[model samples]
Target chain A: MTTTPTPSRPPVPGPPQDTSPTFVGMPTFHRAARAALDDTQQRRNLHHATRTIRDKRSRAVAELPHWEELRRAGAAAKDEALDHLADYLIRLEERLTAGGATVHWARDAAEANRIVLDIVRAKEAEEVVKVKSMVTQEIELNEALEAAGVNAWETDLAELIVQLGHDRPSHILVPAIHRNRREIRDIFQREMAAVGRPAPKDLTDEPSRLAEAARLHLREKFLRARVGVSGANFAIADTGSLVVVESEGNGRMCLTLPETLISVVGIEKVLPSWDDLGALLQLLPRSSTGERMNPYTTIWSGVHEGDGPQEVHVVLLDNGRTHVLGDRLGRQALRCIRCSACLNVCPVYERTGGHAYGSVYPGPIGAVLNPQLRGTESDIDRSLPWASSLCGACYDACPVGIDIPELLVELRSRVAGDRGRTAESVAMAATTWLFSDPRRLTAAQRATGVAGRLVGDRTIRSVPGLGAWTNARDLPNPPPESFRTWWARERGGGTREGSGR
Target chain B: MLEPRDDVVPSEPRTSGQRVALFATCFNDTLWPETPKATVHLLERLGVSVDFPADQTCCGQMLTNSGYGSSALPLVRRFVDVFGGYDAVVAPSGSCVGSVRVQHRRIAEESDDDSLADRVAELGPRVYELSEFLVDVLGVEDVGASFPHRVTYHPTCHSLRMLRVDDRPLRLLRAVRGIDLVELPEAQECCGFGGTFALKNADISISMGSDKARHVVGTGAEVLVAGDNSCLAHIGGILGRWRTGIRPMHLAEILAATEGTPA
Candidate 1:
């Protein structure tokens, strides 16, 4: 019997090549932000959306007299979880297995996608309905599934809008924050049918009508799908439960309707205990959608014989998290609850919108988090650190109290270190050298004053490299003599005349 | 020896017997020497002894914020050495003072120099931005200065967020005789003068500055006043380029004004 030479068991698909957009080739923040600034409609849409949310968030937060206490507890809880992340994760896996769910660990995005793909392919499912999952977006699971001929349907209203428009998410909580109601109507009319059920031809630009169209369009997909994909807001280690907070019922539909359920969660999402949910739940709703309590709070632990998804799978994703945790100062970014409060209040984000950040994550948190998670390896990631004006607004608005400005500064040092020696570095070194000795600084100031004369006026309307400054403002004509010079001659008893005044 | 500029006339006689050292920041010392001079005049007028340590240079904020924390170490050491002898060190610019108070220790710690960190910690509280000194330390809101102009105050982000000198400049401005202190729309927003932020991300910086200039002009104010000249230089540069008929003035210059010397 010629035994068919057993083919080398197809080399277990080594971590499905990470297909997630790393924003690898995107232009620097300055270039991208410039383009974003010129888009007046996007600016207007962002301004309205952010301002509305900012006001609502303020009111929601103010309703709780103990909001600050809640923030402290929430922050402390995350810090504890992060400190003992390995222990908590192990406990979570054990509890999940005990509760009848299959647990898989993915070292990176590629691994995570491969695990999910293997599960779906095993079930012989052609399509999967999805809840709004930032982690899924981070891993680009839908893109992977599509490449493998499995369709992933986004059921959340905003996520559906983004999916239908074939666009990327901008804001963390509201993925379509850059699109106004009219824009949504146009997107629905143009793109809804290509994917699934079409929007009513009579649909107006009114928000309710647009939402209704999305609801009808997504409902068909949610009921027929035998597979569901989700991301958890929090994963409880003690009980092996996953919690999802949402305003709409789409998360509920997707979480319950499918026979085979798969959840791709960040390892950082695991809480040490179920009790930690109270503080996070309270903090998240107010900070994110500006609701005192989310309309839908779904909690599920593995499966029951007759309820929910009978075959449940949990894909624990690492995907750059371990590297982020390695940074002592930067690890604080892990405490983030994906609340877009920082985005709403950030002036930079308000103007440039989320697209400028060039990541699934955007705004102040993205500025720090992306660089750490992705490693300042690309132009976009390197430029993310300088995207802010060191505004502390984000820090104040953060529910978990991440010192975003401090992290931005810290990450900037890393980015600078990677570049070795640029003109800015050389100039900084020279300036520091001049500043090390007061006499040298004084001499430099004298030189600058002499140079000021070459311009012939006390104001310079233009200068090379400082065109950003001179483009809109004028540089003060450098004083003929520096303060030290005036101080030495006049105040310090040196025999020299004050030149100008 | 050269004397104090003829443009500066002491508004009030010195008598309070509080000794203070002037930490004239690098930006003020180089581009706007008049700001520190005004700070000295205002402090001395309130009966405080003001000393200028010749060894003092930059506060190292520019270096630290620009991602050269190590390069800022020598300057941080120089700062502590030059001003550590005094009971209190006052700088005119809120941005510089904010850096000295907030970033100096972090810069030292990041470099793993525990001694420098300790020095920064001990000395940080003693260093005050000008308005902070006038209100928190000296316990004087009104310096009996006179500036008859419709002026609006742009609270620099460092001073507003870092120093928390809210309403101190206003209280001082409110007390100034003949000063029309109008409120600036969105006064707390940054003027986009984030040290090198302007040079590096000039387009965004200009966009932010233009908004500030529009608001300043909308208020019909003759002058835009702020505690930090760095912010003023940015906003003022925009206003100057646009010729909005409004000029940016340092808070110290406004506070130093007297009936005899109109700012």
Candidate 2:
């Protein structure tokens, strides 16, 4: 097994300490989103990449005559599986145990992290190689592993890019979508010594060259790592098994070569049975990568004679999932197959990109899920619900029929009602008082009309509460006459239908 | 203005229940009270009892949408009190009806008033927008209304997707003897009124509004009708600025119009 040399460099500062302040220190979804908006290069990369995937997905989806049926069945299966989750978990646990797979239940992120750490320690492994896993990212697993005195190497190419660049993932599939090949080449030049093989002496900014650079770096980890960690796309309860679907074979190598395999999977990842897995296997790849089938779909049940990892541990994580499940309206979020069709189709997500969401999950699903998982108390999560245009594109694109726009609106209301803590409450109260009475409403409109006249062409340009709005747009001027005046004039004169217009 | 026409003066086919209360929304009450007046005149013509609830007010949707839920709770409770047990509580706006039905329960629960929450939930499903109540609940699509004009329907977001009252308004329009109900292309997308959303994200809002206006003009309908005037007003404002051949009118005003009646 080739051993990648650890690059020596000044250590980067740790994760930001302020978790309680919500959006206090974080930039708004708008500003954060704006960073990538004007980068024509990044926009070209994203637009080209996303459109290709979208076209491919449409073709793949159209090939299946039962695609819609499969989607419905997938949704129904998820619903039924969630309905009987406790029973399914027990069944899953028993079968897995009988098959020589140990199952650990984690209530939240911390517990799951500790469990994975313990497994790595017990295996006496100094380093663990990882396949691409969002759950691991969500738990900040690499940071935990590093803190516990171990190196967690990312094997997936995109994951490698993010890890090597010391950056947060901006897009779910691409992770480093914000970076072009040249920037990637720069990162490789700087960080490649971390792996034993340095970047090619004359590496070009070509895609193949960058990919080869990463492959050369990761090939060593795939062969040498004693422990491997992964996140499952689906865990089948009927037969004790875990499945990782991916475009690249890196996931396969990570799953099979390691002595001890540890998987940190969200509890919501479980499917009811094998037939359910069959349907999902068909849906996931097409919706996710727009491929007819994922190139590498590695499914492992338990210990086998002379093949695969002998020591298998599955860590089932709750991590605010039960609370999400408890909500009748919100629980449907758990049904996500993570196809990311919604994200690809979302106009807001398209323009703003993913980092603005300030969570592992982004796009319409992120807007609803993040707030629900963390609760709306934080300003970041609160602002997420308002991120969408309520355009319903996400809903249209969703395979499982998660009503993202409705959920966003629901979350927005919850945020607004945060015990009346915001300035909007005061404004609403005052406005309501003026509006409930007819006479007051007319007076206020006339008053606004007059005030609108003063701001007429100069565009007021700066207002405190509304500056967030006018920053990019203009406020319309109220007409000289309210509709009431128009009506009154039409009535006073001869009542011709053509008289008003 | 026509001598303050206080006396009924025998309008055609007037209904006789004076107890019906008007829940004129902030949009209608402030921006366009003519909608409420049209509602009252229309309901009065159908011989239905109509009363302008002196305490009737905003459904608190604006505050609730803005993420200020606690302040909006009182408005929910008060609206319930003012209009709850009446024969029916009708708002000219689908968004307001949606708030009363959809959001009030949420607000009531937040306030820890289970009973009030339960009541709001119970009364909420019954609260209907004017066209919905008239057609779906009241079973009266043809209000003896006659407006000889080409009209297209704009389905508000809350009304179309939220309430899922798809064909009731169109069915009513179809039944209207003289009104032409032209099909609107992409009728389900929001007009971007979104309560405070129009002012909050005016750029995207205007973009969405322009899209909607383009659709409205595409139909070549002389008039655009919608259940919620807030959406109509936003689209109307755009149409007014662009001087499109189309004018906006509420469904209630169209249903209320009789022969020779100015719509």
On DockQ, the candidate that comes out on top is 1
- What TM-score does candidate 1 get on C-alpha atoms? 0.93
lDDT (Cα, tens digit) per residue for candidate 1, span B126-166: 99888888888777776788888899999888888878888
For A146-208, candidate 1 gives per-residue lDDT tens digits of 999999999999998899888999999999999988888999999988888888999999888
lDDT (tens digit, per residue) of candidate 2 on A1-501:
122223233222222222322234666565566565656686677666666777788788889998878878778878777766777778888988989999999877777889999999888899999989988888788988998999999888888888888887867777877677888899999998966678998999999988888788889888999999999988889899999999879999999999899999888888879888777888788888888888998999988978999999999987777778767678789888777887776655655667788887888898888878777656567678877766566776677778887688778767666656446666767866764554565566678678756666553444687664445333444545454444445443312222122
| Candidate 2 residue lDDT tens string, B108-177 | 9878788888778777766778877676655666666767899999888777766777888888787666
Candidate 2: segments with Cα more than 4 A from true spot:
A1-25, A28-31, A34-87, A107-111, A121-126, A147-149, A180-217, A291-293, A322-332, A375-379, A401-422, A431-501, B1-24, B32-57, B68-160, B163-263
For model 1, what is the C-alpha lDDT against the true structure? 0.85
Q: List the candidates' TM-scores in order.
A: 0.93, 0.71
lDDT of 2 at B257: 76
Q: Which lDDT value does model 2 have at A498? A: 21
lDDT accuracy of residue B188 in candidate 1: 78
- B226 Cα displacement, candidate 1 (Å): 0.8
- DockQ (C-alpha) of model 1? 0.47
